[model samples]
Target chain A: MQHRLCFAPLNGLILLVSACVLALPMPASAQDKVLRWHDNLDRAAQASRESGKPLFVVFRCVR
Target chain B: MNGVDLARFEFDYDTTWQAFFLDANLNVYSRYGGRDEKSADGRHSVASLQHTMNEVLVAHERRRRPESRSDADLQPAPRSKTTPEDIPLLKAGHQGCVHCHQIAEYRALQSFHDGKFSRDSIFGFPLPDNVGINFDLAHGHRVDAVVPESPAAKGGLAPGDVVTRVDDVPVRSEQDFRWALHRVVEKRSVVVTALRAAGSKPSQPVSIKLDFHADWRKTDLGWRKSLRSVPLPLGFLGYALGREERRTAKLPDGRLAIKVVSLRGGGLAGNLGLEKGDLIVSLAGRSDERTLDDFKSDLLRRYAPGDKVRLTVLRDGKSLELTGPFPPWDTTDTSVP
Candidate 1:
C-alpha cells in the first residue's frame, strides 16, 4: 500500500513532464512574443493600463 | 473492496447511488490530500434520468408487450431536432458548419507578405491580406472578393466581375455556380464568365486558377450544424481601411497637412500616429523610406503588444516625433461598417 501510494505521485510527475515535452515545439503566436521593457513588470503594466486601448503592444530592441 | 466493486467503481466512479458514499469520501480525501476533486449535479440528474429510462425500457420489454412497444412510437421523442428557422445560415447555404468548426476567431488577421514578422522585422504596422470575396452584393451575383493576390486575383477576377460561366457551364444560381467550381481542376487556371452587372445582358468572361494551397476561409460545400454564430467572410476584416478620406488636418508648423484617409486592418494604420484628418509625412525617424510590404511584416508576426514605436509626424509642418505603443488590432467597432 505504501509503495502504491508513493508510485502514484511519481507517475503523475512523469505524465506532467511528458505532456510539457510534447507541447514545446510549436511556433509562437502573434500575442506570444511580448517584449519585456523593464526588469520589473511595472513599466509594461503601466503602459498597458494607460494605453486605454484594450490591446496594448510592447516591442523591445534586443541588440 | 472486491473485484466487482473495483470494476464497478472504475466505470461508475463518478455517479449513481452506489458511488454516493465514495463521493463524500473522495471529497474528503481530495480536500485533505491536496488533490482537486469536483462534481456536477447535472450528472446525478442525468444518471437518474437514465435509470428511469432503463427501468421503463426493461419493464416494457419484460411485459412482452409487442403492441405496447409499437405504441412507443406514439410517445414523445427523447430529443428534438434542432431546426431553428430564425437563424440565418452563415455560409452560402443554410448550414452553419464552418462557423462552429473554426473556433480560431478573434483570430489572426494577417497579410501574405514575404517573411513572418519578428522583432527586427517590425514593418511599422501589420500588413493585411484581402478577403476571398467581392463584398458587393451586386457583384455577389457572380463572385465575391476574389481573394487578395490569390489565383483569382492574379487570374483577372475582380470584385465586381459577375461570374457568368465556368469554361462552358452557365451559373444561374449559387448552386449552379458552385457545381461548376467543383468541376474545375485544382490549381489549373480556367476561364470564367460573369455578367459584370445586375441587369447587364452580355456577360464578360475572365480566366482564373486555383492555387495548390487553398485559403482556409473558402466556403467549400460541407456538412454543418445549423445552430452557430453568423459567419462573416474575411473574418470581419473589410477591404482597404481608411475609407473616411478627404478630411482636415493640422500641420506641426501650425499649418494644414494631409491626413491618412483610409487604412486596411492588419495594415500600416494600426501602427502609425497619422489618424483621420491628422497629418502625415515622415515615418520612423528621419523620414525613413519604407515599402508597403516592409511595413506590414512587423504587426502580423513580429510584435505582441506594449512595444515602443517612434513615428515622425509632419503635423503643423514641424517635424515632431509622435510616440506611442502600436494599437492592438481593435476591429471590435462596427463604426467602420
Candidate 2:
C-alpha cells in the first residue's frame, strides 16, 4: 500500500510536467519570419499605398 | 497574371523567379533576381536579397524627402495598362492561368511570324559576368572580382568599386545592371558609372567605357524554358561522348562526338533514317569541340526553320551521311504547360 502511494504522486508529477511542456508556445521557425506574401498584385499595391512603403513584387513560376 | 499590367511588371520571362522593387505608384526602384545557364538560383542568395531590400528602403526614404520630390524619375509615368489578355496571340488560344514563359514564347512567335524577330532577342538578360564583372554575392552592386583582360578590366572596373549606373539607367542591383545591358541595341560601347571609395573620404563617381565584342550578348540558351519557342528542333536527343568514349570510337581529340540516344518521331533525323546508337561525328563537316547544347545553339544561330542541315554519323564502324531540311517552326502549340 505504501509503495503504491509513493508511486502515485510521482506519476501525477510526471503528467503535470508533460502538460506544462505541451502548454508552452512553439518557437517560431525561420519560415515564420518571412513576410506575408500576397498573390494579388493590386491588393499588394493598395497596401503599399496605404502604408507608404515600397512594393516588392515577386513572380515565381512553380512549374 | 491575367489582369496584371505586364508593362509595369516587366522581367525576364525565361527565369522561374524574378522580383521588382517598386513604389505604390509603380515607379521601379530596382530589380533583384537573375540567372545564367549554370542554374536558376545560382546567382541569387539570401544575403543579396537582403542587400537589395536595404537599398530599396534607402531609396524610398530618399524619395520621401522634400528636396527629392522634384526628381522626375521618381514620378510615375502614365502608361496604357496592357495585360496578358491584351496579347492577341495569347488571347486567341490560351485560357485560364498564363505563365510568364508563355508571355515570352508567344511574343517571340508573333515576332518571328511577323518577320521582326532578332537573334539577340533569344539571349535576354545577359549576365554581368559576360562583361567580366563578377558582383559580390552579398553586396549585389559591389564588384567582387574582375576577369583578367575582360571588358570590365579593360574598362578600368576594379574590385570593390560599387556600380552606380550603366549608361543612363541607375543600377541599384545586379539585375539592374543586367537590365542596362539588355537595353543595349546597337551601341557597341557602354558607359559604366561606379563609385570608388577611398580611405576616410567621400566616394567619387568614375566613368568606365566597356567596348563589347560582337557576341557579347550571346549566352547558353539550353537552360531557358523559352528556348522551345525558337522553332529549331534537333529531332534527336544526343549525349556527348566522354574523352575515353571518344578515344574508343576512334574520334580525334577536341572534336564533336555525340552518341544519338533517341530519335523523335517524325523528326528530321528520324525521317533521314538516323537510328539510335549512331555516333554523330560531325555536323556540316565541322568537327569542332562542342557540347550538345552548344551544337543546338549553333544550329539556332546558323539556320532558321526549313533550312537544310547535314550530319555525318557512324554506325558499327561504318560512316553514313544524313541530310534534310530543318523542321518548320511550328505554331500549332502555344501552351506552356
Candidate 3:
C-alpha cells in the first residue's frame, strides 16, 4: 500500500508535465506560411524585375 | 540585403505596421494598413490587402503600355521630412532591428531640433473613422460601421458596401483610403464609389458625396511618437477616465464622469483648482452623451487654442464649476505640486 501511494503521486506529476509539453505553442514557421517569410529584399527585387511583378515591401518589427 | 528608401514614400508615422505597393521601377502605386488610437491594428483587413494587390497588378500592366501611360500613370512618392539615415537613433549602428515606434520618435526629435515642431507633427495622420467610415479590412474595404447622422451615412454609405474608389484614387486598403483623405486639405465634398452586394447577387454601384463641416480637421489624433517635452495633444495636460474605468468608479451611465487622475504643466485645469479624482460631469453647458472619449473629442474638435471652455465636475463629492482658456501644447512656464 505504501509503494502504491508513492507511485500514484509520481504518475500525477508525469501527467502534468506531459500536458504542459502538449500545450506549448508551435513555432512561427510551423503555424503560418506568412510568418515563414523570406527576408532578402534584394532577391525579391530581382525576382520582380525578372518576372515583371511588383515588389511588395513590408517594414515592421517583431517585438 | 538592401533597405527601402524612406524618403520617397509617405507613410503614417504613428502606425505600428505599414506596407507599400510599388511598381518594379520603385514608383509607388498605393499603400496599405492604418490603425487608430483605440487599437494597434484597427483598420487593417485581409480583403483590403487583396484588393490593393489587385490594383497594383493592374497598375503594373498599365506601366508597360507606352500609349496608355500618362503623367500620373504611376505617381512618385512624396518626400518625407527626414530619411532613415538622418535619424540619430537609426544612425547609431542599431538599425538592424528597427522598430516603427523608434522611427517616429527619432523623426519627431529631429523635427524639434530643426525648429519645425507643429500640431501636425504630434498628431500625424487622422484615422478614416474621423470621416465616419469604419472600414472592414477583411471584406475588402467594406463599411463596417457608420457613425449616426455622420457624413458617411448621410452620403449614402451603408454597412457591407464595398468602397471601390475615393475621389480619383483607387481604394483598396485602409492606407489607400487615408492617403486619399490626407490629400484633401480643403473642406470640400469627397466622392466615394461603393458597390452593394459585392461578389454575391446582382451588384449595383452607389455614389456618395461626403461633405465635411468646418473645423473637421480637429477630429481626433492617432498615436504618435513625441519627445517628453512635447505636451499632450489639445493642451489638456491631464488624463481622463476610459469606459471600463467609469464602471469601476461606480459612475452612472449616459453621463460624462471623467475622473481627473493627474494634472500637468500647471495648465488651465490645474490652475483653476481642478485636482486628482475630480469627476467631470459636463463641459460647455452640455451634459448629454457624457463619456470621457466623446467629451474630449468634442472639446478639442469644437474649440481651438486660447478658447475658454466651461466645465462642471464633482470633487470630493461636491459639485464645482470651472472655466479657463485652452493652454498651448508646449507650456512649461507653470508648475504643479
Best by lDDT: 2
Clashing pairs in 3: B45-B137, B256-B290
Worst 10 residues of 2 chain B by lDDT: B69-78
* lDDT score, candidate 3, position B12: 67
Q: How many steric clashes between backbone atoms does each model show?
A: 35, 0, 2
Per-chain TM-score, chain A, candidate 2: 0.45
The number of the candidate with the highest TM-score is 2
Q: State the local distance difference test value for candidate 2.
A: 0.73
Candidate 2: segments with Cα more than 4 A from true spot: A1-34, B70-80, B233-278, B282-294, B301-312, B319-337
List model 3 lDDT by residue over B1-337, tens digit each: 0133556556765565566666555666767666765677656655456656666677677777887775354544565544566665356544353444555655555555555655444444556677788876675477899988888978989998888778777666777777777777654778998888867668798889999755444545423333233442432434455668768766666676666766654565754567777888888877754445456556655555577878898877788999877665443312111
**Candidate 1's residue-wise lDDT over B1-337, tens digit each?**
1111121111111111121101111110000000001221211232232232333234334333555534221211213222222122212133322221121111111111112212211111110121244423222234646666665666666766765455654433332233344344333444655555435466444555434233322321111111011121111121221323212222234222234445454433454444543344443433332222223322233334455665555444466666556544333321110
Point out where model 3 deviates above 4 Å.
A1-27, A31-43, B1-4, B65-76, B79-81, B84-98, B102-124, B127-129, B132-138, B142-168, B186-210, B222-230, B233-250, B253-265, B285-299, B331-337
TM-scores of chain B alone in all candidate structures, in the order given:
0.24, 0.80, 0.68
Q: Which stretches of candidate 1 lie over 4 Å from their true place?
A: A1-63, B1-131, B138-140, B184-188, B196-204, B210-337
Alpha-carbon lDDT, every model: 0.29, 0.73, 0.59
Candidate 2 lDDT over B1-337, as tens digits, reads 5666777766787777777777776788787788887778788777676676666777787888888754433323327778888767788888767777778888777776676776788887888988999999878889999999999999999999999888777787899899889878889989999999887999889999999987888877767667777655567888899988988888888888888898876666755678889988888888888777777777765666667888888999999998887776544454445
What is the lDDT for B152 in model 1?
Answer: 61
* Range of the 10 consecutive residues with the lowest summed lDDT in candidate 3 chain B: B328-337
